[model samples]
Structures are given as C-alpha cells and as structure tokens.
Target chain A: MGQQALCYDGTWKGLLSLIFDVYAYKYSISAIVTENNAIQSLLFTSALIHVVTEDIKSARVTKGIITSVGKKGYLELYHVFLSEKEGRELLILRTVQYYLGVKEQASKNYAHADVLEVKKIVKSVSRERHRMKAFIRFQLLKDGVYFAIAEPDFNVLPLISKHFKDRYADQKWIIYDVKRKYGLFYDGGEVQEIEFGTENRLDQKSISLAGHESEILYSTLWNQYFKSVNIRERKNLKLHIQHVPKRYWKYLNEKIEMGG
Target chain B: MGSRIQEKLSILADAAKYDVSCSSSGSDRKNKDKGLGNTGAGICHTYTEDGRCVSLLKILLTNHCIFDCAYCVSRRSNDVKRAAFTVQEVVDLTINFYRRNYIEGLFLSSGIFQNADFTMERLVRIAKKLRKEHNFNGYIHLKTIPGASEELIFEAGLYADRLSINLEIPTEAGLKLLAPEKNHREMIHPIKYISNRILQTKEEKKIIKSTPKFAPAGQSTQMIIGAAKESDLQIVHAAQYFYTHYKMKRVYYSGYVPISNDLRLPAIGTEVPLVRENRLYQTDWLLRFYGFEADEIVNDMNPLLDLDIDPKLSWALRNMDRFPVDVNRAPYEMILRIPGVGVRSAKKILAARNFEKLRLEHLQKLGIAMNKAKYFISCHGYIQRYADQQSERIKHFILSGSSSKYVKAVSTQLNLF
Candidate 1:
C-alpha cells in the first residue's frame, strides 16, 4: 500500500533506531518527525508512529556504516547530523539507502544524488571549522585563563577543540559558543564540556568578569599594531572583508574598534 | 596609537614591510609544559590591507644604517626619523604578542650598525634570551648579516628556526648598479655557511639523541623583481641555482615598490610590476612542485612570461600536440598537465578510476573546474569536439571568463597580494 510515518526524539541515536525499524517491519517510511515538530494525527491513513530508540538497534546500524564506508565516511555521517539544515534526517536516511543499494563503492561515486547532497553539507561544516581556526582569538582573563566567545554558524566546538588544546597546552582557556549555550574548557590538563545555567545568557558583564587589569593595555597595543602594519599605499577593503567577514567582529579583539 | 611602544612599532613595522617573506611554516615545534606557545602549519592571524599574510611580529631592531641603497626606504641618506628597540624590549614584545595570539613568533632584521659582527651579535642575543631564559618554543626567523664571523653564524642557527639573506638584485651587475655597498659574494657567504651547518647537524642528530635541532625549517631568500632590467629567464635561472645548490626551502619574489627619486632608481610614483611578480611566483611553484625545469618555462625565444595567461596554461597551449589524453587511463603526471586539474584532483582521479571508468559528470562532482579542463581531456563518456581547434581559439575560450570584465578591471590596477 503506502509508506508509514514515524516520529523520533531528534537525536543521532534516535534516527538510527528509526532506520532499524524500517528494515525490521519491512515498511517504507514516508517521513520522519521529531517531537518538537508537531505532526498531524489525521484519520484513515496508513501510518505507524512509535518512539523506538533501542540502544542495540542504533549500535548495529552505526557499525554497519563503519564497516561499509571506512572511518572517514563515518565522520561525514556525523557531520551531516550536526548540520543545521532542515530535513537533514531524511537526507541522511536516503544516503544510507544509496550506500547499501549499490554494488560498487557509492561514496566514491560523487555523481549519485544522495552522495552529492551529503558531501555538500560536510563541506559547509568543514569550512566553518577552518574559519574557527583562523578567526578565534583568545583574551587574557584575570585568573590567567584565556577566554573568548564565538557564535559560529555551525556547531563546530567539538571539531576545533583539539587544535587549541595542542597549541595552548601550557595555559588554561575557555571557548564559549554563546549561540549553543555551551562551552569547551581546556584547563592545562584536559578538555571538558560545560554549560551555563538556563537563566543566565552571556552578556557584556559576564564576558569581562574574569578580565585582568592589564587586559585593556594589551588590547590597545594590539589595536595600534593592527593599524601600524597596514600599508596605506595599497589599501583594499574588499580583500580584507573576504578573509575576515563582518559577522565575526565580536570575537576578534583587534577588529572590535572598527565598529563593524 | 601615540604611546612610546606604539611609535616604535609603527616605525619599525613600516621599515620591515618591504621584505616580503612572512611565513612561519617549515618547522613543527611542540610546546613544553612550562612554555606558553607552539607552532603549527603557519597560521595567518590577520591579513594586511595589501592582502599579505602576517604570521610573525615582523620588525627591525633599528632603522639606523651605514650603507645607502638607492631603492631602500631605510637607506642612510634618507631623512626619516630614527628609532631602535632595546634587547629586552624585543623579547618582551614577542612574548606578550605571542601570548595574546597576535602572532606566531618574531621575525627580527636590522640595518647594519657599527659593523656586521656587532649587529649580528645583538640579534643573536635577543634570540638566545628568548630560548634559554624564557623557555620559548615558537618559530623564529632571523636575517643573517653579511660578513659576520663563522662562530656567531653557528650560534644564531642553534636558536633560530630559519635563517635568510636577501639577494636584492638577481645579477652581480644589477647588484653593483643599484646597491653600491653590497656584492653577490658577501650575501651568498652566510647562506652557504648556514647550509653546510644544517647538513652537518642532520648527520649528528641521527647518531646522538640530544644533539639539539639546528634550523629545522631550513633557509629561504627573496629577490626583488622588476627593480632592474633582468629578464624572466635570468630570474628563473637564479632561483633554480638557489634551489639546486643551496637547498633553499623557498624563493620569494617581491615586486619592487618605488620609494626614492634617485637617478639610479625608478621614480617615486612608478607603478609596481605586481602582475609580473605573480607570474614569477607561479613559475617558481612549477620548479619546486610541478617537475618543470627553468628552461622549460622561459627560454631564449620567450624571455618574459605572457602576463595574460598563467605559466601552466601557457605551457599547455604551446605544447597542444599532447592533448586529448584519456582521464580514465592517463598517468598521474599527464593528468597534472590538464589546465583545471591541480595536485589534489589529480590524485583523486588516479584513485577513483581504478574502480570504474569516470565520466564528465563524475569529474564535475570531484571538484574539477570543467570549464577549462573540458578542452584537453577525454573520459568514458565525453571528449572535446574542439580538440583539433586552433590554439588561438582555444586560448580565447579558456580566457574568455576573465577577458570579459575581470581582467579589464584589474589590468591597470594592482591585484591582491
């Protein structure tokens, strides 16, 4: 007859379990919905809704993807989930279908529609990861810990923690993603994930609470150095904006005086 | 911007901007538990308005000089304000700027003061204090003063990651004309001294465990382009000699920016040959990475590069009798000759084609710039109908994208660095 509709809890594991149900019940799924997205409960429809998030089923599906496409492909699947694109769940499900249906290796066959869609999302996430490495500048706090706040367009904190952890091993630092309401803290030993309480949003006062007295002195020196190094004989604002866009001004200490 | 340190930074930084080598790569140093910084794959924290990469605290120890070079802004005859930083001031500025993530490390050069040995001694002391006293482990690129003693040159290499001595003019005749005080032998002496020590240490490190690294990033040098009447072939020959003989890591080409109105130099308002500078860089890349020789790019017949097309595309158009190679079966070297296929895509095509024959659509998905590569290659499903077309028509087709409006807009004006 027709395909059935399934609702999940909108997690990576929850989506994997839904995939397991698709094979177990031998019924094609028309759509997948999370709880936040209210689905209409219409009458006289061939729909089977369930909250089936079995740990065993999710683990099996993850193992199958790893065995088929190697470790790099597995990471691309995770990146697809972390993306903020709408209807990414269904797009990921279709990619899994294309991977299993083909006889030859499908991930290398970029001509496939499902593979192309997933690679596009992976490219976007990796671009954000590179920009984070280039644009994230830390400020010295009063407690000797360097702190900075960034609101990247993608969820890239997990992807960029190792870079800072290796480079700044002798100091303590915290990179708080204000938009995601979480932070990554490296306290001279190891990295840990932290979260602020629900009531307090990161504001101006909270950002400078741990500021040392000499922080302003160093910042002004940096601003002066930034202006001094610029060769006015060949000034091109177009190229400068291309590398450091306007959206990332707040995170950069030197660009703050430019007033965006 | 009017503080004492700010004043010195402006003067010193402006004096040092003409040296177009700001790279912090070629050395991989890890941070010790007590240190505050480490080096990675050359992070450019910021780009100047000229689009040049700024990875290090590029500044001079002092602007006081004893010699007068006609093209130099910091020549002794020029009436610019004089400034100098103390040894402690440079160490502190580097540490603080590095701690705040403003730069990767320090690039300290200076105008000759009193004598070559005296000036070299001061530069070595600043690097020594940073390494031994402060326990810093970041990238340090020091400019080696000509005629310094062998003992001091060896000591500087022990602390610095990379050392360089600029060959400002390509030929000895050009050097004699523009820079009266400098000769080719004095400049090449330090480069050879540093290169021999680097080789000697490589052998020592293999046997002894605690030998201590010496200039692990190797050495690089820069030559000013368009400052004199040297041909492109002459410049490429000089670069090839450096790469083959000196084992140079890189050769940077700086388009000469006019500064003075001396009869020996161009007028102050003369335009910088930026396009020729870019073409020379492309030719240098071919020598270092693309398995092309110096004579293959510019010969006696073609003494200069065609400023309209890049060096690689120019090579391909001249040798079009070797076109229409099968992408599904061509070797990796041949695949690299295609106009749009870079090093990355060439490797990808080699790996992907073993499983199945590739098509035009598959090539597009693999990130090939098809608009340019379509005229030179064939696949399982597609071949260029214009493969036998005249070279001029094919060149126009390839360059039509830029010839429409993009090249016209930037032809007269200087492009980004």
Candidate 2:
C-alpha cells in the first residue's frame, strides 16, 4: 500500500514528462494522476511530482518520437494510457524513451514486443475509425445545416472529416463527437474544428420546419417516394433496421414525420 | 395523363420496388460539361423499408398494357389505375431528379402502351432527349420490350447503360398458361438480339476505335420465381444460357408476390419465398465469381434448392468427398469450395499465406471465422473430421446457425429503423 503517483495535468506533454521521469528514476511508473487517490498501493512505492510545463525543447523531443515512429506509436501510447494498463503503458513508455536515446534504432519494424503491442493498438484504432465512418448519421438542421452526433470509442472525429467534405460539398454540416466534446464543422468548403463550449444541445422541434409550408412539401414528396418504393410483400423489418439502425431514426426526415 | 402518370407511378413503382437490381453500376461516366449529373457506381440516396437502395428513378413509361401477365400488377385485366408518361414528362423528371441529387438516373420500363414497337419507340425518345437535348451522362436502364422491332431495340442499346427483358416465368409452359401474350421466343429473342448488338459494338470499337458504348453495363434480366412449376434447376439453366451466350452482367431472380387470387398465379396468403430468393442469389454468386456452372451446382433431377441450407453449403454437402481441402497448400479455387470462405476472404487467405505458412492460429488472425471454415479446410497439418464424419448432421447444424444469423441480422436491422 502506497499513495498513487501524480502528474501535473492531463495533456499530451504531461504524459511525456511522466515518461521522462520514469526513465530518469529507473523505476517503472504505475500511473500518473492530476488528483489525489484514496486507496494506496501496499507492495510498490509511489512517487508524486508536479508535471513540468511543455517548453520548446521538450516539445521538439516529443515531436521527434512521433515523427520518427509515426502516428501509430503516439496512438498506442495514448490508448494504453487511457485504458490505464499500468504495466503495459510503463513498458511502452520505457521502450519509447530508450528508442529516443538511440534515434537511428527506432525503426517502425523494430523487433520488440512493445512495438508489436503498439501495432495491435493501432489496428484497433483503425477498426474504430472505419466503424465511425459507417455508423455516423447526419440530421438536417433547421438552418439547412446537417448535423450528426457520434460517441466513437476512439478519437476518430479528425479522421472522418475528409469523407464528409468530399461527399457533401454543396451543404454545410457538423459532425460532433459528444463523448470527446469536440466537433468538425464544414462550411461549404474546408472542415474546421468547433470548440466544445461554442454549441449547445440541439433542439429537435426547433430544428424541424414541419410547421412551414415549403418544408411540409419537401417532407411529403420524400414520404411519397419512401412509401412508393417500399415493397410490402418483401417487408423484412429486420433487414431494414440493420442498414439503418433505429438509433438514427430520430434524425431521419422520413422516419421523424411518419413516426417510423 | 399527368394525373394518370402519378397514379401509375405509385402503383408500378410499388410493384417494381421488389426488384433489387435497380443498381446503376458497372459504367463510369461523369458529366463532361455542365450536365445535370454524373453516374458513378450505384449512388444510393436512401434505403426503403425493406433496406433496398433507392438510387434510380425507377418507374414505368406506361402501365397500360394489352398483355394479361398474372404476376404483374400492371396486367391488362387487373383493374388497377392505368397511366403513361409522355416522352417530355420522363425527360423533365429525369433532369429535375438528377439536379436535386435525389437519383442517379432513370430505370424506365413500360407495359406495352400499344404494341412492342410503339412502346419501345416512346422509351427510345425519352432516352434520346435526355442524351441529345440535355447532354445527360447519368445511368439509363431501359427495359427492352420483348417483341420490339430490331431497329427499335438497337436504338435502345445505343442510349442505355444496361438493357433488361424479364423472363417473367422460368418455364415455357408457365409463360404459355399464365401470360398468353408472352411466349418463350418473344422474351429470349430480344435478349439474344441485344447480346449480338453488344458483341458487334465491341468489335466495331476494336476496328474503328470510336464506336459508342453499347449496353456498357451489359445486359441484365429478371426471372419471376414461384410463379411457375419450373424448378430451381430450370431457372439456373436459363440463367446460365443468358450468362454464357448473352454475356449478361446479372440475372436477377425476383420471388413472386401474389397480388390476387388469380387462378394462373399462386395463392396470395403464401409468403414470397424469401429464403429461396436468398439461396438463388448465393448460387448466382457462385456461378459468376467462384467458377461454378449450373450443371455442377444442381441439375434437372435435383430441381429444387434445399430450403434449409444455403446453395453453396448444399453443394459442398453433396460433394463431401471433396472435404477438408488443405488450406495451406490447396489452390485458391479449391479453397473456395470450403463452405464458409467467401471470395474476398479466400483472396485474403491467399495473400496472407504467401507471407507465412498459415496454421489455425494464423487463419484466425487473418479474420477467417474458424467455426464455419474449419469444417471444410485443413490448416498446416490439421484437418477437421467432424464435418466429414457426420456430414448430414453437420449440414443441419450449419444451416440452423445460418438461419439464426439471418434472423439476428434481420432483427438488428429492424431495431435500427
């Protein structure tokens, strides 16, 4: 039983500083905390240190590891940190710190268990990235802005912007990841990040123009098309929901008006 | 006619809605200048309640017909709302819908407005206007009127990305009894004619190097199953003939939906045999992609597809002597016979195995669902004996699992919408 190790803040720079501390102390760090813990570790001793603020030199050194090992290395360390896999994270951190000391030896194909583990984490992240592409649903907002909300397991918001930008070039849209509290907004051109506090919870009734004349016509025409195209004999309700999950039914124009 | 057009479209599009091959695929034509829209691989704007993609502006040119085809809602004696679109109206609709990004292009069919030639000419006029007047480069699928004049059929081939003529029933006798106006020769003649035109166009393109694309997405046809007494074997035979002789892109089998208590058609209460439709599609894939022939899969003696098992697994079960193909050493085609290995998964196995000798562990890592594939394939030196030993029992086991999987997929899909 011992007190949990603490770091200054929960930024990328703070995590790197913790890695540096582990290397300097020659002792594997269990965890880094921004706050105190009630339970203490009995078998292993813990060290608490205020995280050093990121400077030009430290930033340059961390950027070098990322640039050399590529984005996969950085993401592996991030996922392990998020999962709070103490032993795995410590091993990865120590390996990265050692590799940084010998930059030429830090090839992506390096024969190390830590490197392979990082590849697994990278694979998982990429799978999550593809899932977000498939599952993200866009709701047409009142001001003609199509907004979508997702809560992907990983930070995939930045990766999916290119797809929407190319596909919906004529429209303005926003895809927000509520879990990460971040969003990507496309304003008929390039995509940009809209900060967390800038937007509020979307009001469904306010966004819908059902009461307006033109909106009613558009909805009626769409429903006409929807109803016309449905094959009653082949009404496999199961297959319909698979392609378009009911979770997205709230935002779909045809579904919303018809109460499908 | 405009009011009539709306009424018929609602009825005919509702009828044509079940045909899943409304896809505008296989041709890659972009709008050259400031044309209304471009055609890419099947751009689905939305999915209907049945989860089918709605990409094409699927509609009939005219639903008024002289023929009394029992399976069709637009049959002459059905007493349904009748309508026909003017050439200009179809052109306007295509342009407007394309501009709005609501559809990729038009899938135009007719129900014999006057005769085959007359109806075919009207369809040709619509395509001509869309291409010549508007310079529209989007996908156009024109249903060839079976007995249309050769000249009119040729004109349709010039403008359409794909041309189709439905073999509404599987057997000649069925066509004779149910649809007296539609004979075997009438239906097969246009398919043969279009196939020859397509081949001739390809030859012309080779010689002059500037012939226009002729049915560039290739000719596809539909067969209405369960409307006749003909077995799956007969349907597969006709499909094979179309594929080999006509060089068809696809033969879509639509399960019959009995609309009325017509004596010529089946009872209305019976289900459309969706499971049979699913099995046919799987077998169709085998024919196209897996180098399987209709005769090899099933024959006249083995007329009906086993309702319980998928066509592929049924084929594998019958030929159990070809079981336990060595995954590590067998050729890609041989590995394809293993029930669970899809075309994509088989290709993945081939690619990944080249990097290393694949064991059960390696196959698992390569994303092969071992439970299904393991029964049919051997990894390294290990072969699964259970599937071969209790082949009948294994067939039932696998089929039940597949049925449940489909059920779950359907449930999950329903929950989504």
Candidate 3:
C-alpha cells in the first residue's frame, strides 16, 4: 500500500479515537483528515473513515494529555479545538506526541515547534473570547429575557457564559452566537445550552422583537449618551478602531446612529 | 413638558466628560438576592470613538456651580445650558443603564449646586438608595465635594467603592492664579479623613469579619496639566506625596483642553498638550509598576521629560552604568527597570530561566520587546552592540533618524560615573 489516510468525524473525541486506532493497529498513518476538510487525498492512496467514536479511548487520551501538560495547557488545547483552524486536529495530535516523552510543562517551553503553534492558536482564541465579553450588547426583550447576538471569528460562546452568568445572575438572558447557530439561555436559577436545529435562520431584525418598546428607547438613550461624552477636540478614530474594531460595530448599539 | 431622560443624560454627561476618571475597576461587589448587576474585576462595556473607556454611567448630579474656575467648562462665567437630575432620577438612570450592561456601575459627581454639604448629602443619598433600597451591588465611584463635612464624607464612603476629590491644579500658587476659589487645603482635608477611615476599617476587618468595607477600592485624584505654570518636577512631586501618604490608587493627568478665551488659561483653539499628557502617564506608570521613585523620574536638573524618548529610556540613558542587565541573573526589580521589559515578561523570564538558560532568542520568545531592551540588557551568548561606546553615542544611535522629528536637539553630554 502507498500512503494511507485515516478519515474521521471532525470532533475532538473522534480525533482521539483515530489516535487510538493508530496505536492499536500499529498503523503507520501518512495523513489524518476530518470529514469536513476539503483537502483531497493523493491518487492511489487507500483512505478509510473510522466509523466509531470510542468514548473510553478518548477519555484515556484526554487524561494522559492533561497529566503531561497541566490544566492551562489542556484548556489551551480545548480552545484550539474550538478555533476550527485548518489542519488543527493533526496539529493537536502532534502536540500530544511531543508531550509523550516530556515530564515537565512543555507548554512553557516555546522551543518546541508543536508547543509554539498551539500557543499562537490559543492566544488568538483567547483574544476573540475577550472581545466577545466586551462587545456583547443585550437588548431587552418583551418577555424580559435580555437577548444579545454575536458572530465571533471563533466559537467563544462556551468561554463567555460563566462571566455573563455571574454578572447578570438576577436577570433572565440569552446570548446567541449567530454564526454557530446555537446559544446560551440563563433563567433566574440556571443556564442551559440551547440550539434551534435546522429551523429558521434568525437575523438581527427578526430577533429585535416589538414586545418591548423600551428596547428602542433605551438604545436611543445609550447612543445619545455615547455621543455626548466624546470630546470633539480629541477625536481619534484610528485609536478607537484599534480598541473596538469595525468588525464589532454591527453588534454595538452606540456605533449605530440613532433616528436613522 | 419635563426634560426627557435622554436630554438630561446628554447635558449632564457632556458636563461630566472633563473629569477624566472613567474607571469602574478595583472593586469586587457581588449581587444580592434582587440586585440588577454585580461587578467583578471591572469590565469596559464599550470604547467611545475617542478611545476612552465607557465603563460607567459617568454624569453630574447637576451642572450649576457657584465658583468660576477659569479652566472649567461648567464654570459660573461660561454660557452653557444648566440642568439638574433629582435624587430619584439619578438612581433610576444608574439602575436602568446597569441592567442593560451598558456600564459596570455609576460614577456620580456634581458641580457644587447649593453648598458642599448640600451637594454631598444628595450624592450620599443616591448611594444609600442603590445599596439598601435597590439592593444594587455594582461599583460606585463618588466625587467627594471639597470642604464637605466629615460626617457626610464618611457616610458616602460606606456605600461607595471609591471616593475622589480633584486637585485640579498641582501647586498652591498655580491654584491661586487660576482657580482662586479653590485651595489645596480644602481638597486635602477630605482625602486625609477618608485615608484614616480606610486604614481603621482594614484593622477592624482583620479582627471582625463583619466590620464592613469602607471605600474598598480606595481613593484616587486628578490634576490638570498645562493649564497652569507647574513644571513636570512639581507634578511628579505632588503625585508622589499623594501616593505615599494617602495611598492614592491613581493620579490622572488631564491635558488641559482649551475651552474659552481667558487670560488665566490657554487661549481657545490652542492644541491640547496631548503629548505632554502621554509622557506624564508613562512617568506615572514607572512610579507605580516599575519601582522608580519620583526624583528618579524628574529632578531639579531634568525638570521636564524628553518628549521624543520615553521616561524609562531617558532614565536608563542618564544612568548607563546600570545598563547591560543580565536577563538570567538580574533580580525581578532590575529586570523591570530595563527598557521595554514589562512586569509580565520579567516574571516570565524568572520562570522560564529556571528550566534552562535564557538566550536572546529565548527572551524574544518570552515576548520581550527586544529592539528597546537590547541596549539595556544582556542574555546568555548575547553581546550589546553599543556596550563599549559612551551613553551619548548610544542615545545618538537610537535617535539618529527620529531626531529630525523633535523640536529639541538630542542631549550630547555624557554623565560618567
């Protein structure tokens, strides 16, 4: 056989199971591809999809990676997983391979190429998460559930849930990641991960409900306050764009002019 | 018809914009059973196009003042529309703004409407209603009126997280020249009282867990720069005194934005001293984070910070015998003093070098700004290019191309040890 390709579902657990398959069959794999990846295999290479996602095997692999590289490294691994970066699954597997022979924290040792690659991805994902926390603007809904939407470059909804849960514990709220098509809903008591699968594509106008008239009024007042506080003499749009980039302006109430 | 909340917000927020203290940080207040918001490690909701953080619902209780400070936009002599928010109005606005997550909390200041106590009492009542009645646990920063009664200031601290009294001008002589109605003593009295109470409450809390926190975020003050004739040395000295004695959290420098044609202040349409303001902030950071003293930053000999170079680099150039700090063997303090080596990177160096010797590449990997730190630091297998040269030559090499951009020529004298 020429170079062999192992194809699996594009999930962390699936990737872990593929790693188990490599060791189990003594398979000298040439490349690993996920189901959604668009990269084509070389001609005349045997490619097979590993059907089952073994839970026990994935758990063992996760524990081993965590024990080798600390909790922060493990979290970085997860963040890179959520990043949906191209060739990320294979990169993560390679990073784990580097950790196999080392005992001390390899994450801090940036000399390792695998660790450096993972660190760069982790930093970018963390920045996207922080930007989400700063930019999410909740508009009051008619049912008293404050609703906000974001289309982050990375999957940051899982990261920002805890912060919003703590700060807005007394109120009912919903934060929907429009790009991911899923959301987090927090009642007065607990928060639940929600998904509206294969249904209506909820756009901004569709969700800006008419149930509460004060939503428009409050947003108008906020825009007014935002405009008045800015000193006309020290107008620095370049610096402002550096902090709150144009990519986030669609979600910000203050960025939009009122009565338009 | 009565003025809408939108109109009042516009007027009062515009009036309060010049105060320059928009921070909603340093307080960790948790929401009770029915509060609207909680503050944990302050969050900036948004940044205005001017790049200032809109962290709080910063507004004045009223814009009607008795004193005519020449530099103030809200001075009694200025022809601006006057507006006032009632006690209930202020409380309602804070709660509504906070619920929508538009702010971390409230920063409430007033323009001394009736008297010091009268204005301060209303400020205290608003805080009381937010904490006791509304059960709101968001961060609150109250601007204590100068010459306000001790009792009112104490009560205000009970509910607010931070209390501030602006020393608008740095020196007494400067204050007398422009803002004659204001004096240094009136501002310093409330600060002293608040500082003593903060210390006493800390001791009580150690003994009794239920002693209650008093201004738990501490107090901060502001001074307007370039509005009066005070040297950078004078400003740094006054800031050091406030930080050392009162334990002030911050001393913000507002680069006086010219408002009107007054002989006492800069003429209207004169450019704000933004570059000077930025240099002062860098100097302040050196004092707070980098373990540099006020005199080390600016003394009688060097009264002003070099406009082209940063304060830390200037200090390092003046004291060149301290250069070439070994990244591996240097203590945390010495590493911090090196140019472009921040607190985070210094700690990282200490941590990573324990595993292996740090080379120049290792320092770069740890995210040190090598371009500036290269002349001041030495790592394993690393050689400083200008180590054998005099400090004047080194400074010249760094500023060769940029010297044309600055109005003042580069200093050529080499201070030898």
lDDT of each: 0.82, 0.70, 0.83
Measured against the true two-chain complex, the DockQ scores of the candidates, in the order shown, are 0.47, 0.20, 0.59
List the candidates' TM-scores in order.
0.90, 0.73, 0.92
Pick the winner on TM-score between candidates 1 and 2.
1
**Cα deviation of A157, candidate 2, in Å:** 7.9
Tens-place lDDT digits, model 3, residues B3-103:
37778889999999988887777878777674666776567778777778888989999999998888888999999999999999889878877877788
Clashing pairs in 2: A1-A41, A1-A42, A2-A40, A2-A41, A238-B410, A241-B413, A241-B414, A242-B413, A245-B416, A246-B416
Steric clash count of candidate 3: 0
Give the candidate order by descending lDDT. Answer: 3, 1, 2
What is the docking quality class of candidate 3? medium
With a 3 Å backbone cut-off (N, CA, C), the pairs that clash in candidate 1 are none
Question: Which has the better lDDT: candidate 1, or candidate 3?
Answer: 3
- Clashes (N, CA, C under 3 Å) per candidate: 0, 10, 0
Candidate 3 chain B superposition, TM-score: 0.94
Task: Estimate how well candidate 2 is docked, as a DockQ score.
Answer: 0.20
Look at candidate 3 and tell me the lDDT of residue A58: 87
Off by over 4 Å in 2: A1-215, A258-260, B1-9, B34-36, B86-102, B131-136, B206-210, B387-390, B396-417
